[model samples]
Target: MLREALDEANNWIGKVPGVVMVGEGRAQDGSPTVDVWVTQPVSLPQKVKGVEVRVRNSGDIQAQ
Candidate 1:
């Protein structure tokens, strides 16, 4: 599911001018999670777009 989201995100890149993707991760509330932050220029009126996928098990985290 995570890979699918990334693939979709990749397809959006270059098609939208002034768009950039940033990756981030964190462990909060005793759960591990990953996020993708898609940023665009503020003047363009589009705010940051993003997706977060929770890492369910240790195996899932290892796979990433």
Candidate 2:
């Protein structure tokens, strides 16, 4: 499921600007979730196609 979610999120990389990386992670409740690390604040959809999205801004320029 994580792989599928990562794949779905990867599809938005090029299409959506400011996306730094996308990976599988856990939610606050320990449920599996998709993590999207972004460099800057960008308008994003709650879900990409049907996959839920979790956007985070770490302000880590080393990644940029």
Candidate 3:
């Protein structure tokens, strides 16, 4: 279930402005979640395919 949501998010993540990364993770309550990292605040759905979506601001990502 989580994998499905992760794949679905990854498929269109590039279309969203400010998004940098998306991955699978466990929420504070231990429930499955799709973590979304962004360089700035952006509007996103609260849930995707029944999985919770958590968004975090990661600032600018640079290659080292």
The order by descending TM-score is: 3, 2, 1
Candidate 2, 1-62: lDDT as tens digits: 66776787788663577777787777778877777888888877676555567888957567
Task: State every prediction's TM-score relative to the real structure.
Answer: 0.35, 0.72, 0.89
**Predicted model with the maximum TM-score:** 3
Q: Summing lDDT over every window of 10 consecutive residues in candidate 3, give the lowest-scoring window.
A: 11-20
lDDT of 3 at 54: 93
lDDT (CA) per prediction: 0.38, 0.73, 0.89
Mark the regions of model 1 whose C-alpha exceeds 4 Å error after superposition. Answer: 22-50, 53-64
Candidate 2 Cα outliers beyond 4 Å, as residue runs: 48-51
* Pairs that clash in candidate 1: none
Candidate with maximal lDDT = 3
Per-residue lDDT tens digits of candidate 3, residues 1-64?
Answer: 8888999999997469899899888988899999999998889999989999999888878989
How many Å off is the CA of 40 in candidate 3?
A: 1.1
Residue 56 accuracy (lDDT) in model 3: 84
Q: Rank the candidates by lDDT, best first.
A: 3, 2, 1
Model 3 TM-score, 2 decimals: 0.89
